[model samples]
Target: MRSSVLALLFFACASQAGVIIGGTRFVFAENKKSISVTLKNRSAQTWLISSKISSGSAWPGNDGAVRPVIPFSATPPLFALHGNSENIIRLVGSGAELAQDRETLFMLSIAAIPSGKAPPGSVQMAVRSNLKLFYRPADLPGDPARAYQALGWQRTARGLTVENNTPYFVTLFKLSINGEAIDNPGVVAPFSKRQTPWCQASSRCQLSWQSLNDYGRVMPAVVTSVYTTSQGVSSRVITSASPSR
Candidate 1:
């Protein structure tokens, strides 16, 4: 019995480590039938893989209240993976109409459920991985790559004002004003605005941002001149670390 429990523990940890997900993030653009994600199990034990999709910034919890706005389905919802095996999960959009002006975001959860019962008195747990899914509308007004260009930054009395002039979302990974780092990075919704109180009063301060790349990885930070040589805001921008609108 002791040996059985030890074996279960070893396999549980090994199986979790062996699961490999292909990308840090995924994009399902308009006009594409579907996209495929490859999941490989390198452990000696079998894994029962399952998936579900949820919408917005919130991921689906134990409760089933969350629903997907831009519908998508994961094929092979439940599958068994033997040792050193791989499976492809297809994400297909439902052809339902969504807002064409901005991008919609979702979350895809992939769970690895171990097979067999735990040792009589031992506990078993399933390992889970989450990835962001971006649904880009065909008619989105501007290029997401240039979203930063349209962002308007102004020095306010209390802090900084960031205005989004384009239809794309600007996801901030790291933001600093006058060399002071912001507490938490945030997202500026399409054509929206955000204010950061980095100082008590306005000063001749510089601004910079580190954002997400296409792979969902954080890119190197870039210093931005909030104003052009003519003291006007420029219409050129940079990229960052998460899915964009």
Candidate 2:
């Protein structure tokens, strides 16, 4: 006889499995030896908790055969989390060499499997949560909080081009062009550029955007004007900042 299992995957922020992760995103500073994250089990039943760290590119649905070697480790990788109880998971670095000038990204995965036995031929549900993990090296130039201010924007024939010259990753959201919302305005990696196909041929266009801070809090909205110059497209900030709603 063959058995079947049903798995439900969720990001840390949207997890409904009674297991609460303390933070949406975790930062591991190079100067620190390790960092601890709190996990609370609110259900009335026990669960088998498993945690691991993986490269940022790895997704929960990917096969394990092609998984990259993880440079960090989560202590107490496997444990029985009692109901209405809390546990701490420590993320420790393996002293592996990473980028010294820029921040490296990783993913922390937590899975909670029901410990009780289910009825015969019944489906079992397992909940897995993934959270972003950023490793910031010490003595990095510029302030991370203000890094988004340095982002460069240009209006192209196809769409908009965003440039990030800073060494910190910028997670952008709530993007709009000329009062129209743009779908899936994703993140811009450190020292990189990304283009989104959304702009039309306009002499000047208003671009509004918001970014997330290190603690996952939404930063203030910034509105800028993109002008089609004689040489090329350029941008100027009309409003540097505004209160975040």
Candidate 3:
């Protein structure tokens, strides 16, 4: 069963017209497991999704050389979606079925919501990465194609890994957190335009908060992809003020 609950109030507006997309700027790699993205079918007709998670081109870096696309493998990253049931994971393009491209590692995030009228300024989250399809129009059971347009949102996040200034240890790391299930398959933290704060142990000890109080993900979710060449030494530590703050 699916819940009619709204995750985040974010959507993309199409004043004159434009392709709809979803995902997040932030992705938390808890122990480095997986990542996900969501989409809505907004086409007057049903559409299929195709994908290509490539190790795109590279440019100049600090050392002056080409670098990896996302600090992680662009080939077949894990993909899954939530369902009516909490933690309910569904692979892309299955049940309720949506079409997708061949050489793509489809995400498991399912298509649950299909708005008949996505206003001109429907708000969404992700603003980085290339566009990649995640859903089709047919995903919606009986929703007429009349007042609707099949929206196939493709989330392609951009990333780069820093060596942590360690000539060794690879200095590799990855970070991504799930967004509250509206689209993202990792975090479920909602967004707020207001400021909210919190702390524990002691007011000056340790705490975490979004601009609304905890740097919440629709607070602008962002992800960091990292990797170590592993061609040199291992285990590196960084605790310098070289940049001088």
Candidate 4:
């Protein structure tokens, strides 16, 4: 269930679009009123760009609460970009009241709507894209750099429960138990816990996880072992700070 939820969250993250976005993710800080995202038209044909802000959840539907809960707007709600040209889309936050304790996650969906006619006997294709958007409170405690180190790991009857005790988002790029890969690699929300069905009972097992960096880059993996019977969890950061190129 967790893997399926994460799979939906990661969906369309790498979807192809005629226009390329500037960054892999967007960050909205409490001190700032807004942030901008750049869109570049890479195709030879002109394209229309339409964007919408939606609630970021494991599973978001039309009925789900819209994101930010705070008032925000995307400039040029609709626009056209010529080939090789680029435009900036501004996201402005208007003093929306959100939890001041942790970072809130949102999603920016961009659709490249074709305006003109397709080439002879060719069908025009419109591409859709999704990007991670995070709203960070100024007073939020703890930095993401050290959050992974502080994550709580426990061996449970279902498999494993990884808990995020910090206020920053921790993206798990890799997860494994006893040299066997567990398919729970994804972002673990702040102050939330995730469970995996890797095992049916509490057992001594080796565990490892690689977190994602600020630029949406993968970080080094940390490997450790834990015993179910032990009263405390012992996890050590084995890898260095060097990020993969």
Candidate 3 lDDT at 228 equals: 27
> Order of candidates by TM-score, top first?
2, 4, 1, 3
Say which candidate scores most in lDDT: 2
Q: Please, what are the lDDT tens digits per residue for candidate 4 over residues 1-245?
A: 65555444333332353578888778888889879989988667677888877767642111233445735678877899888899989998877688789877777888887777644544455677777777888877766666776677666667666788898877666777777786646566777777756554436667777776567766666666656545554343333333344
Evaluate all candidate structures by whole-model CA lDDT and list the values in order. 0.69, 0.76, 0.22, 0.69
The TM-score that candidate 2 achieves is: 0.79
Best by TM-score: 2
Show where candidate 4 strays beyond 4 Å. Answer: 1-17, 59-70, 178-184, 201-204, 230-245
| Candidate 3 local lDDT, 144-214, one digit each (tens) | 11101111111112221122111111101121212222112111111101111211111121111111111
TM per candidate comes to 0.69, 0.79, 0.23, 0.77
Q: Per-residue lDDT tens digits of candidate 1, residues 7-43?
A: 6776567555767888867888888989999988877
Model 3 lDDT vs. the true structure?
Answer: 0.22
Flag regions of model 2 displaced more than 4 Å: 1-14, 58-69, 117-124, 200-205, 229-232, 243-245
Between candidates 1 and 3, the one scoring higher on TM-score is 1
What is residue 220's positional error in candidate 3, in angstroms?
Answer: 13
Tens digits of per-residue lDDT for model 2, 76-155: 99999898999999998888888888887778999888787865765556677888788899988988777776788888
Give the TM-score (vs. native) of candidate 3.
Answer: 0.23
lDDT of 3 at 41: 37
